[model samples]
Target: MQHLSVARPARAILLGSAGLLLSGCSLFQSSAPQAPLPASATLPDATISYTLTGQGSMPVVFQSDLGDGKDAWDSVLPLAEQQYRVLAYDRPGYGASRKTATPRDPCTIAAQQHAMLAQAGVKPPYVLVGHGMGGLYQYVYARLYPQEVAGLVLLDPTHPDHWRRMQSDAPTSAMAIKARRKLMFTSIETVEFDAQAQCLQHIDLKTPLRMPTMLLVRDKFGIEELGSVETLVRSQEKDWQRMTGAPAIERITGAGHYIQKDNPVIVNEAIKMVVKKK
Candidate 1:
């Protein structure tokens, strides 16, 4: 099923699995000025920018995981924004958004995201698409406001087990730690991480998610000698299948941790399917 392109060893450091490394794609950075947002919605002081496009019955809000902001999704947002009333915003401390006391971890980050969406006048019955760390917030969002999410699309998301196993000396934990250290070193600053880690500490994975969701995992096989990409994908596949309790899963071929960069077509298709379903 992996019928796409682009794969290079990520020298910039990885944050999850050692086998999950990828060639980081740079699109829009937080420093760039975004295109004008839809007039119907406005960017508050807490966010760098919030754009709402599309006029569908249900709204799709895009949230960046690392607080890198909506600019990171420059390539993909317009496509989705045209179809649904899509909303994308930069969380505090990253883009034009104000640096607030809010933490970027699961529980507090989830609450902040929900509150921001509500304040922006974007509400429940939404189709949420999150990538990487954003996947964690999406999970927390769905759990916190189950009634608000209509469909979910997770692109190689981060799971609590991914971190827990890393610290537990499990076969997968070491790689997860390496990935995190690499990523944390490259993207997150020391001060930012202190706040981020504090918020992440309170998240308990015992909460079960019941929303209809699709997890698009990069199927990396033998990309690195540390572990077989096949084994990595299978392990994550089992975890996601159990976590979401959804029988449907898509194995994106020839992709690493960043599936969104590997192939946006898969993500677009998956989101459309979930949103279009009756």
Candidate 2:
């Protein structure tokens, strides 16, 4: 998914004059904002923008990749709505949500999600469907509130160990560190990226997820575009499979990073697997 470029100016004003670096497809264009949900919820620093559709016993909550908002899941919402209650929301600074200078750490982000869901009256035993960077937040949420999350579907998620593995090259390591510091002040996504990396270092992998989990890996990553780093990313995907202990692992062919957009059927299949678990 691409980034939201036009929102940069407005975000700069809210965050600081340092320039709020924004990325991802336009939140509106990606999902084509439908009629507003019947209600909204106010969090500590920002009022989240979300849509709740369908009605069922267990809710399917969707979280988008970095630089994306809830709408990124637009393609799969209709299918999911046929059988489940669906919840998709914009994070603090994405889409219609208010901007904040929050620390953007995984724990803080996960906590806010818990509070937002509670305040919105969205009940628990949730089946979390997270894409890209959003997977990190979902992982933390499950860890912090294990009783609430029933299952998980990770769609081409960023492996927690990606940074540790990718930094083997000295040049890449230095460049990444420098870029992260620069983006920290200008981009909310960047801040979260750094925080997730830090959080991963302390994670106790010995504690098994032990829930119904599915890990989806894209079969084709444009190696030409990524250069030599493509090899490292592919290696990390294998590592993620082993680390996550996901019972089902699917390799989606003919799809790029945004597998949901490229192939909704596969994504939906993954979601259904978890949702059907007893």
Candidate 2 Cα misplacement greater than 4 A, ranges: 1-38, 169-186, 225-227
Find the 10 residues in a row with the least total lDDT in model 1: 1-10
lDDT of 1 by residue, 123-197 (tens): 678888887667767776777678888878887775554544434434454565455555654343323333343
Q: Which predicted model would earn the best lDDT? A: 2
Query: Each model's TM-score, in the order given?
Result: 0.74, 0.79
Report the Cα lDDT for candidate 2: 0.66
What does candidate 2's lDDT look like per residue over 194-228, in tens digits? 67666555565556686888887655543232444
Instruction: Say which candidate scores most in TM-score.
Output: 2
